[model samples]
Target: MEERLQKIIARSGLASRRKAEDMIREGRVSVNSETVRELGFKADIGRDEIRVDGKLICAEETKIYVALNKPRGYVTTLSDPQKRPTVISLLPELGARLFPVGRLDYDSEGLLLMTNDGHFAQQIQHPRFRVSKTYRVKISGRLTGAEFRRLQNGLDLEDGTFVPDAAMIDEINPKSSWLILNISEGRNRVIRRAFEKLGHPVLRLIRTAIADLQLGNLGEGDYRFLKGWEIRQLMSPRRQNERLGKPWEKT
Candidate 1:
């Protein structure tokens, strides 16, 4: 299928559509070895020999989608300036410069989507996507029913505030409480902060699901590519609406 040059560049994960247009206008993009600065320039992605600043970019190879059952102690960044172990290091065999779609803090673990598909990545991270991400969290102490209700309502924290789309105690042990938390907001440390504001500290956090997608039996530090149908479902507007529902709807 043919697409605008900038669209292809955005899909390549180099930049967003707007940024790609800037690159094109700067005479950085070319088609068939000829510089193309026209904003409306189009090309058949599979047939065109496109280059960005003299480097060929394969549009077909631009998209890569993988899900990782992230283990603790790995940062969800491409490469840290501090040289911390990064998520991309785990996918050495993937042979593509993919990035984590959203993020999972070093101490948190579970289903994290990695991709080179810029538009897809942007869609997932965009607040408008409203994708529900589910996490299994183990907190240090048990909370009363009222305390749990407070979390569902929303909590104000020192750093910020947060509210889980859905939060419940799935399993209760003597010393630890296991909770299932679904959140639409991708704020940093949201789940942890919500519980902290309620005076409960999280000991462990594991992302178990994203929308209809589940981590399933994926082991720690293990990953698998998203199947074609799975990708389609995640991108479909209908499915997104179904997963997110309308604003103010209860989780």
Candidate 2:
């Protein structure tokens, strides 16, 4: 079947459509050994030889959904230029190339989603879904009364003020404090940065849940295929709606 080159790249999970176009414009993409810089180029997936950055890409048609209990040391990206260990290393048995739905900071641990379905990935990660993420955090010192009040109201970071959807001091040790927070946005290092801005440097951070999905007893460094209902609940109406819109389901 013929498709836009950008669509092909995006579907392969190598980059989003916009980024794919940029890759083409930069002469980073080649079809059949010829560098293609035109945005309107189309290629037949069954016959054309397509390569991104000199690496041949086999476009994935089968969608696979997976969840992993990410440990603290692994970065969430597929590959890092620094040669750091990534979450992809944890799923060595995975046959399909899966991309992380959203990133977890290298030092933070917990529930993470990986998949090959672009639409599902966009749906969950896009801000439109308003998916809530829960994190349990430990900070280096007990929260001062003013800091606690400020956190409860909102903490002003230089970049932005984060008013957590829910914030609670779970416990206070003499030297440290344990707290939990729920937030709908995926701002970079928001929890840690927010705490630091409030004068309590974060010692540990772990995401325990995403929306209603819990990490549960899934041991660290383990992954499992999402069940059908789990997929439906997370992906929601997008996948099913598309299938019903297309006639291939009847065939």
Candidate 3:
């Protein structure tokens, strides 16, 4: 069957549908040796030589989904230009290429989802899905009640708001404190910057859970494939109006 080019790229796990659309607009995506910048372009996945950045993407394969207990100091990208270690290296041998669903920064660690199912990744990433992520953050100083309240009430960040769905101080000491924050909207450096804005610089941060999935006792750098039941749970139609709704469109 013929599908949108962005859909093919996204389904191939090369990029999100939105990112694929932008790449198309940027002339990075080509079909059968010809650069295709047109939105809503369609192609047959099996016959077309779909290349992104000059690399031909293989035909769709059985989707792979695994969870990694990411340790700090590993970048989330597939390949870092500065030559930093990426989370991709920590995976066990797998035939399908896996990409991190969202991201965990170099300084932060914990449960990170890796998968080759572009549709699955996109669904979890969509805001309407309401997939919340919880993090246990260690800060340099104790948080005042007012400061914690401000986090719950939401504060303006330079780029956007730092509104946590829920927040609580787990523990406190003279020198440091641990706080738990939950937010469904996963934005870059959101948790750290949110606390930083309140004078509580984050010393250590670890994601504890995402939606119903927990980091569990999985050791750092170790990963395990998600069970059939787990995949079914995540794919539930929490929200359906949005690619695989808006394809080849700007995010």
All candidates' lDDT scores?
0.82, 0.82, 0.84
lDDT measured at residue 20 in model 1 versus the true structure, 0 to 100: 92
TM-score quality measure for candidate 3: 0.71
Query: What residue runs in model 1 are displaced by over 4 Å at the alpha carbon?
Result: 1-62, 158-161, 240-251
Q: Which prediction has the highest TM-score against the true structure?
A: 1
Q: Which tens-of-lDDT digit does each residue in 1-251 have in candidate 1?
A: 88999999888887899999999999999999899999999998789899998878775564789999999999999788888899888886666788889999999999999998999887777888898888889998877777877776778876666777766677777787887777887878878777777777899999888878889999988889899999988887877522323222122
Query: Which pairs of residues collide in candidate 3?
Result: none
**For candidate 3, lDDT tens digit of each residue in 1-251?**
78999988998888999999999999999899999999889999788888999999888677899999999999999999999999999986798789999999999999999999999998888776878788888999877777777877888999987777766677888898887777788778988888889998999999888777788899989899999887877787752211111111111
Of candidates 3 and 2, the better by lDDT: 3
Cα lDDT of model 2 by residue, 1-251, tens digit: 98889999998899999999999999999999999999999998779999999888786767788889999889999889999899989987667889999989989898999998989888888876777788889999878666777886887777778887776777888899888787878788888888888778898898888766778999999988888888877766443211111111100
TM-score of each: 0.73, 0.70, 0.71
Rank by TM-score, descending? Answer: 1, 3, 2
Q: Alpha-carbon error at 131 in model 2, in Å? A: 0.6
For candidate 1, the per-residue lDDT at 167 reads 67
Q: Return the lDDT, model 3, position 133.
A: 81
